[model samples]
Target: MESKGILTKLYSFLYIRGFKVWTSYRTQVALTILSWVLPVFTYYFVGTSLGNSLVERIGVKDYTSFFVIGLAFQGYVSSIITTVSGRIRNEQLYGTIEYYVLSRSGVTSFLFYSAIWGFAVNTINAFIIMSVGLGLGIKYDINWLSSIIISVLLILSTLGLSFLSAAFTMVIKQGNPISLFFSTFTTLLGGVVFPVTAMPIPLTYLSYALPLTWALQGLRGSFLDGEGIVQEGGIILVLLVFNVILIPIGVLAYKYAFRKAREKGTLSEY
Candidate 1:
């Protein structure tokens, strides 16, 4: 009961803090919405220009819809890494990280709640982006149940990467190259703008190593092909395996990095 009470307070603190931060930057919020929406027009035009050839190559009936789904999922993936890492860096820069380390609620709890807030905000952003795409006439035959299942798995897999990024932020202090590299790598290789099959053999094999590859395949299967969880069983299994393997490794890495940073007297350094 005491533990549950602690969790409740921690959650309330994180949620209120997130709400305050978002509301304080109304103009930035509007620009962020515009940034997400504006890219769809460029993709829509490019997809239309390519016509049926693009559809045939991608094995999807509508290139615009395919691209839109990929882009939406990319938003979720990017947010997890960038938000977790960036929040830690921001706390360090603001000299509040030491307080986090000393907090009764615990640093890990703070990190986890911050990540949850980021995931919630980005999920809403993805939905808005998809709605805008639909308004632009990007058609989808969505399987809501399957999409939800795939989304949960995607979030779980992504949390592993998020934790890894947080670990790097602890050690590096600033300029998280791992986050940047993963963002670009996933964009190119996770079939965000194009199909992974179009890549060379080596690149195709390499793409399979990233959890986002299976996530995109599962998402596209549900969104574009109307596939269910049963139909996407293989991709789901792969993602499950990734979550099981990566999450523990990521947590241990973060804990080790945090400890090293403290011992080196670098945790509060910026």
Candidate 2:
């Protein structure tokens, strides 16, 4: 095959090829879609039970829309940080890590693109969650341009951490403490399911350090209140700063880890 054809096949397999296998199971599809919706109600009822106080305290118009946005976008952050590491783990188990790590596209590009399917699946989940919120009469005043910009900023910021997670996987070939720590802390501190103000003061400071906290705030403002880029300028700047600091460190760590792993001849160890 020509180089162009080869590249096309590689991307085809990376992107939609797994869809056929996944959809082959009818029950899995139904259950997966249900899983996306069930959580919306879970949080909805839970938030409603707490009443308007929580909503007011959080500065959101209502708890339903607030929690809905948080629940929906949290999936993207999780997917970003975990997908590449999960791909590496699977490849290691299959004894195929060496092939991709040593391939012409190299480990960085191969592992990064390998995560496209996971992001696509998260998009479906986000859409379903938003639809459920709408069905429940949760209103939104979306600012499309700001929403897109914030979403992209969120993804890029999280991508840095994901790169670091991949590097940890390459080196350890097993449990990943780096991703684990961030995942745990992000849920508690990043204000994914709750307002950061609910946490103690010190913890709130830590929450401010997380990219997800800023992303969720900016997203909720744009998606629920129609706040535009000018209104979201501070958030955009914070996310940009995070990207600037994290991406370079992550890239360096990942490249270093990959080089060391290859030198140690343990790229496929698992």
Candidate 3:
């Protein structure tokens, strides 16, 4: 009876959908893992071919480390939108969204919890990419305090954006402007593959407006330039301003949108 009860609890509580797919197709899992590292080499070769001018333009000598940090960190920024919105999207299609919306803890926590695995996968992907960069001679001079501060700010900004995107998804059911904006422009303007300095001065102003751009600048400064939190105080301030403004706006939008959806009886509509 004890063994049967334990097995029943495991079956009830464990989510095996994504895991089952990976287990059934080991090759796909391996390739998906390998794909994360491949970009490090692509960027390295591109950086090498571009030569010293590339490094000089970015004002960072180590091209590998610069792009590596940019790429790894942007995953968290970009993934927050897709993951949270994707959960709501999936629930809508599965017709299980009504249950989530009616749950005591509600749709906000429901979507947040369901989307966590994607962030975990993003974390693993980041670790693998950074490890590959290390193998390719990218060096770090990390200041733990600065990294932690910048990371927390980045996460807060991401959560704010996540809620905003989720709010849009709940209503629109497709092609949210918030998600579209981030998806289309974040890689180009967020300093993921290149410094904002490399862009035209007007575009540089736009880049500075992005939370990812500030976060990456501070993160790279901490990891590569051994910058302390005090050294990156300006970046920290900008991120705090973003958190303060965006978080409340996001929460308000989420509550309003979710309430609108419920009122319209559109919970399961795709």
Candidate 4:
């Protein structure tokens, strides 16, 4: 009962902190929504201009739908990566790193909870983009159940990546090159704007190594092709493997980095 009470208080504190940060910047929130929505519109126009050729080449009926969904998933990926890395920097800058280190919740838990706001914002932006796509007459035959399952797996995989990012932040005490590299690499090669098959042979093979590639493929298979989890079994299996492998590795790396930072007396340093 005592442990439960502490856990509840920790969650409540984190929730309120996230809510306050979100509401404190109403203009930034509005602009962020606009930023996400405007790209869907631009893609709609560009996809239309490409006509049915992209459809024939990609095997999806509507290029706009394909592009939008890929971009939406990428948005979530980017958010998790950036938020996990940035949270440590923010705490350092605010001189609150010591508070977190001293907290009963522990540093890892604190960093994860601090990213709640970013995850929520990204989710809202994804929904807005999807809604705008539907409003623009981009049809989807989404398998909601399968999509949800894949989404959960994607989040777990992203959590692993975020943990790795957190580890980097703990050690480096600076900007997140990992987030930047993965964001750009996945956007370009993970079939965000185009199918990976369209890339050269070497790039095609390289894309398969990325978690986002399997994620986007699974999502597109579910949403665009209306495939169930069973139908997308191969992609699902790969993603599950990624989660199983990456999560433990990420956690160990983060703990090692945290220990190193403390040993170096750099936890509170920016």
TM-score for predicted model 2 compared with the true structure:
0.92
RMSD of 3: 4.3
Q: lDDT per prediction?
A: 0.83, 0.83, 0.82, 0.82
Cα lDDT of candidate 4 equals: 0.82
TM-score of each: 0.93, 0.92, 0.88, 0.92
* RMSD to true structure for each model, in Å: 1.9, 2.3, 4.3, 2.0
Candidate 3 Cα misplacement greater than 4 A, ranges: 1-28
**Residues forming the 10-long window of minimal summed lDDT in candidate 3:** 9-18
Segments in model 1 whose C-alpha atoms lie over 4 Å from true places: 1-14
Poorest 10 consecutive residues of model 4 by lDDT?
9-18
Candidate 2 worst ten-residue window by lDDT: 9-18
Give one digit per residue, the lDDT tens place, for model 1 in 136-189: 886778898989988998888788888889999999877787689776778898
| Model 2 local distance difference test score | 0.83
Residues 58-161 of candidate 2: C-alpha lDDT, one tens digit per residue: 66558888788988888787876777788889889999877875677777877666556666777888999999999998888999999999888887777788
TM-score of structure candidate 4: 0.92
Q: List the residue pairs that clash in candidate 1.
A: none
What tens digits encode model 3's per-residue C-alpha lDDT throughout 1-270?
877864543443234644455458889878978777787889899989989875777676778888999888888877777778887898899999888767665777665554454566677778888888888888889999999899889878888888899899989999888887776689899998888898999999999888999999999999888999789999999999999988898889999999998899886899
